[model samples]
Target: MNKVSKELKTGVLLVNLGTPDSPSVPDVRKYLREFLWDERVLDIPAVPRWLLVNAIIAPFRSPKSAKVYRELWTENGSPLKIYGLANERDLQTKLGDQYIVKLAMRYQNPSIQSKLDEFQTSGIKDLIVIPLFPHYASASTGSVYQKVMEIVSKWLVIPEIKIVNNFYDYPKFIAGFAANARKHMENFDYEHFLFSYHGIPERQITKGDCHNVCKFGTCCDNITEKNQHCYRAQCFETTRLLVKELGLKEGTYTTSFQSRLGKTPWIKPYSDDVIKEFGKKGIKSVLAFSPAFVSDCLETTIEVGDEYKELFEEYGGEKWDLVESLNDSENWVNLLEELVLENSHQK
Candidate 1:
């Protein structure tokens, strides 16, 4: 059989959690209005979710978030958007002419709907989506997948679409993270390391437990068919892989969750609390890693780098450093190319 023409084009859409177009309160409010309204995010009845977001969360939270975002913003705009665009450009170049690469924000400008429209007109025969999140969570990767399908379902002639649900265990992905963290450790002789991931509500987790096996205990200690898709399990497994690769002592490194919202319980051993405890225990310096995000954004840049560092220092701890994310780096772009090529070859 003759090989498919290089011009037959496979479309690649790289999606990220998104950012406000600007750091102003109004822009931040607009961004939060769209992000928190998603059922996958807040995960409540429509009426209550609307009230919580519009009446309370957006009104109160946006101003504070906007300030932090302003600190993270650059001349080019949001770090998330900037890195995302760079990755798109580099991946397109690396993948060569046969592939059409586009980047989309899950909640803001350059939306999935618009990108899918572009792909439809381009006459592509196949589409591959890689959500920038390393782990699979209902609020992140799952929501992106749901949104993309919603947009494409109406098309009369849909392309062969494949979505990458999770790449937490991908060697290159893990290596990229380890490489970033090592760079930081090499500069500072930190006493401890923390792998802090974005937190999700516990209820959201139980809903994904098909076999009713997620008790938030040893059940998640090992990944299995029962909880293969469990968010917490994947997080633990990711930490484990990184721990081994970095040769971290068993007790010296810990896994914690960050960026929690609301009064309701989230994943336990919260990152803030962990840091505070380390402070009280007189642990001086520590290196923090946010593996949940592939790009440098508000969470890793401000939340972990600034807010948490201050909190730790207030409690008498000395240095707290946040390892930079894998945004647009050569290693990360190479991983994206490999991911696209591997997914495209799958039957």
Candidate 2:
């Protein structure tokens, strides 16, 4: 590291998708409006998006979504937010006093703009931004990058910024997940495994693929220059890395997409279908991994762990389990520290 780089104060900003402040219908409605209203998420004209979000989805879905959130919430608060705060504190300790660390949510309280305000006032000359999703997607990581850039563009004295958009295949990250899975493996000898990542629309995949190679088959078996930024390809790549690290056999495991919304042709091989197939095929035991997320939130905890478990069991499948997310683990903290130091020196 150069002397000048060492002297300038650097700020580390960690961000995640925001959650509803509470499980109440009004709170969930507010969160859904902000989340679905994002152009990148809904991908429609302003009028259609506004009408769909305000007039239809939020009003109709908010109450039911609020019910699910009620099941997922705990005494402390939202697990995603809880873990984000924990990661901020641990990463700060890991990096020591030389760097400043702050946590932000892309939508709700402690927003990206507000956190950047603190960095701007602190006279930081360099900043490192790490979005908490492992796999890169336009709705998640890309939205975060766009939000940060849009906010920072207005600052009078913008800092040099380095963004770690995604770390799907980072060594420590891969190991942390493998370790968690191993802990589950110690007790149960599961017969089949599912690597279920969050689903995005098909257009998002094609949008990132410049070479028109995202046929969603062997095209994602290996990452290439064309499919490098493709969300589907990256999800597959993350599964491949986890399989290699965990020594999971080819036929014994399946990579599928979950949390599909609106039924607009998301990536192929949906997770619920795969689970049913496993049950019909007489696979008695199963283990599920959600490597796309770093923290346990509504998607991982309730969606994957709770709802999917019920679906799997309804088909006569037995012993379904979801390997917990990294979620403020020591290795996860170490991974963030490494990302900050490594990127801080580069930009």
| Alpha-carbon local distance difference test for all models | 0.90, 0.89
Per-residue lDDT tens digits for candidate 1, residues 52-84, read 999999999998989888888899898889899
lDDT of 2: 0.89
TM-score for every candidate vs. truth?
0.97, 0.97
Which residue pairs clash within candidate 2? none
Deviation of model 1 at 60, angstroms:
2.1
Model 2 residue 111 lDDT score: 88
Q: Please report the TM-score between candidate 1 and the true structure.
A: 0.97
